[model samples]
Target chain A: MTVSTALPAVPVTAALPDKKNRRGNRKNSTLATVLLLLGAVYCLFPVLWVLIASTKSSGELFSTFTLAPSTHLFDNIGDLFAYRNGLYWRWMANTALYAGVGAAVSTLVSAMSGFALAKYDFPGKRFVFNVILAGVLVPGVILAIPQYLLLAKVGLTNTYWSVLLPSMISPYGIYLSRIFAAATVPTEVLEAARIDGAGDWRTFGRVVLPMMKSGLVTVFLFQFVAIWNNFMLPYIMLGDDHLYPLTVGLSGLLNQGANQPSMYITVVTGALISIIPLVALFLGLQRYWRVDLGAGAVKA
Target chain B: MTAVTALPTETRTPRTATRRGRRAGAPYSFLAPALILFVAFFAAPIGYAAYLSLRRVKVSGLGLGAGARTEVWAGMSNYARSLTDPDFLPSVYRIGAYGLIVVPTMLGLALLMALLLDAGRTRVGTFSRTAIFLPYAVPAVVGSLLWGFLYLPRVSPFTDVVQMFGVEPPDVLTGSWVLWAVANIAVWGGTGFNMIVIYTALRAIPTDLFEAARLDGASDKQIAWRIKIPIVLPSLIMTFVFSLIATLQVFAEPMTLKPLSNTISSTWTPLMKVYRDAFVRNDIYSAAATSVVIAVATFAVSFGFLKLVGNRAFNQED
Candidate 1:
């Protein structure tokens, strides 16, 4: 790994020469490239289909070829906006609000709790850590029904708080933040801050947080994507269409496709539009996408 | 708190002891939010689900007014009903089949892709990696919708391609093929993320370790089979476990595809059965019992698999 990193821009294939049988090596390498490209095509086909499908009108959607692009992109967008007096835009905004606000608050809470678990010694710490770890394995889908029932008892169902409140408590976020805090924030610096008459909160907010900036961004992106992509929780929690996130909203539109054939185009358009933000986030934050599952990040 | 930090440590007094007490309290104070949320959302829900599973609604005389139907203890009747429901066992079997198809295929493809990318010979590694991972950014609902359109006869370019060769396209959304259809959706969305994980692990292995194998006249496939696969077995095991968990809880893809396919029942999977029992059939008690059953099964499968495997992947004792 170090050798490959040092020789940047030199392809790894260039180093595989055996000083004999060059043609056979070239053929094998070409085969590998073709096989990889085929895999790429398989993965990108659906995304490409959605991109082209969203450009077609209701009539052209069934009438024209699947891959052919039409000039109805703006018309489809206009129709999606005009449907139910701009309800699609509302779903988009609701999704952004849920992911943005939920992730922000979740990140802060996880940072605090994870910092405590990583840096400080207290009674029952191991118990708390083990329970949170168990929470990580608790399949979140199983909790949806019970959470809905409990929230309904308190008259909190079908409300934004039903989704946002639960979204703010991500066990995986805390686990990642704990690893990040343990890795990035040094104990010597923390002790120095404490010796300089800084309180715990002040030291954490001013010093520890800055060191954990990249990891916290990773945590925020992860929770944001999870909440954004979530369907079952919001589907069970919110009864009203106006409160629906993109997943629930688009699914409802797809469900309506059995009766209303035109909704197929709308669902396609909504799916295409909904994925733009996530794909953009992925491309822009490519470096922070590293999730070291083998505990290497902490051990580093 | 700052004042306590400023106090002199030379004099071991009660004030110092109080500062030590405050230090002990700091971690608890910091953990207050997570602990509260965990208790409310995690622990409370599981407990309430168990309680609801053990109880049922008992209707009184006439069963008309607000107080007519009261909640009462039902012992194990709800669990008995849920376990005996004809839909329940089939749903479990369907999920078992789906997991068998999905977990191995997805992880195998993921492992293959990771090994190919790690082989360091493919020219399109970066492009293919991003393209394959692009689906992870798309939501399952949206991904299913896209694939659902592709499965349709009128909208599928695949059908056109097959027809161009004078062959009929197989109906992918039919009863016989719906499992594979849903499994494909899972594989499409899951493979990229797992590939990245395995690829990250593969990258962590030093190139020098494999350089010696190459110098010994071993081919790329031989090197990957002998050296790379064994070194990344832990990562593969971890991915397999996670894929198993996710496969068992598949709800979104099948739910999204139900609008298109007649084969998918309202209770297609165990989680979906829980959904229908709770929301569609208005049987929250039975649903609670079924969810508990599914949760227990999941934990058993996961922990049992780990215990059987001797926990070599996650041996972090420290």
Candidate 2:
């Protein structure tokens, strides 16, 4: 009877503000919807330009309507392939190897280090973590020159190792893994594993590893994309055209295009093709990356 | 492979240290692979470059042989020469000009988009947001390549469309417009990440704070400026720092685009200058000196700006 009396008065109390809230929300939403569509169009325009541009023939590329589609993508790709004995294929493969293999190894290294740092008690742990943080601030570009010289000293320059070896450290990846480990892995479970006679290595490999998988995947993706997008390190490291990744190989072609104006079509076509795989990968993996990546910028 | 070779500890004695010290070994052990590579590649090279910068080849008798040319102390001469070189100033000036165009436009678009996303009324919000961020996955080299071809008179569909109106298409790769052309590429590639950063900070905000404003009949723009912007100011500062750092290191786009344009010099950027000195000129000393200069400039600018901003960005953590 007391609750019934309180509810009839409560409904009137809520009703006035609810009416105002609905009006406010309706106004806010319509304005938001228009703004969002405009922002999306600005973002998508360049991509649309490339798509339509890629379809046209060399002569039609500039001659046709900017948004109009033509039928030359297939021929443009054929031309791209025929150049330098299909060297573009080599670049694609090289990119996959560098990013795919390097990110995988880097993620594993970061995961183990992060797990140990987060779960285990150790001396100088603070110092180690701080050092990793320091490494993060130091731009990778500064390290590139020295890295090149060092690799050259060991006769590693012009080889794939020149690019792959340095990328595998990823201080940032380790920093991320540590955060992930702390958040995802429960302390009591690991302690129980140790008490149950499981070795440290076994516990990490079996018990902690599975728990850190999602975060580790995020770490791997970050590193993979970073390595794939990396231009300077690979640009400076590899000299052998045969060893060039897509970036270096494509840049070489662009350089040659200055003298041969017609090669512009080929470059545009290649750009369109190159983004296809990663765009597919991004769309596929978008759901898993809802976590705040800003907070996740690896401390390295 | 690194996975196999780096596995299996070289020394296994059931590693022991004090509780505080025990974690020391594991991080170092995990970091060992990175450290070894770091030293071999990063530290050693930086040291070598510094060492090289302080020394130069003393060529004797027309520099006939390896013996005739000896590495001797150049002692600030290469740095002095590099500093006085007139070519260096224009690169700095150009970057300043380029940064002026890019930083504001990119961040402005990012903030606007982030606010819209936070407004939460748009359909396919996820799809749109992801599409905007898609270019982030494309490498700088790839991004530049895409834009480079689009800038071509014969290759630009926009040019085709513009020409249909009977007006000549603008030459983006030409003088004056080249900066915009390059700046556009940076904007395209960078806006997504900044949007994500800004968007993440917005998402992290407690929602009930806005519920009151809604009751007060606040417009979405009013809520964004009066409420959201103030709340995410720190993230903005954080983004500003990162964007500043990234802008200084801009190299590959111009470097890649240079092959297609005569306007981009061999020394179009500070980093590019370093590459040319080291590899092209075989002046490792000069390259080292230039790199150290750029690195110092980077740190100085960042720390100095922090001081000017009253040191708030990094104040709380310490």
Q: What DockQ, between 0 and 1, does each candidate earn?
A: 0.46, 0.28
The TM-score values for the models, in the order shown, are: 0.92, 0.86
State the displacement of the C-alpha of residue B126, model 1, in Å, after optimal TM-score superposition. Answer: 1.2
lDDT of 1 by residue, B209-310 (tens): 887888798998898899988887777777877788888899999999999999999989999899988988899999999999998888788878777877
Model 1: residue B35 alpha-carbon error in angstroms: 0.9
Per candidate, the number of residue pairs that clash is: 1, 10
Model 2 over residues B143-188: C-alpha lDDT tens digits?
8887776677866766657877999977888888898999999988
Runs off by more than 4 Å, candidate 1: A1-28, A296-300, B1-19, B312-317
lDDT score, candidate 2:
0.74
Off by over 4 Å in 2: A1-31, A291-300, B1-27, B154-170, B303-318
Would you list the clashing residue pairs of candidate 1?
A1-B207
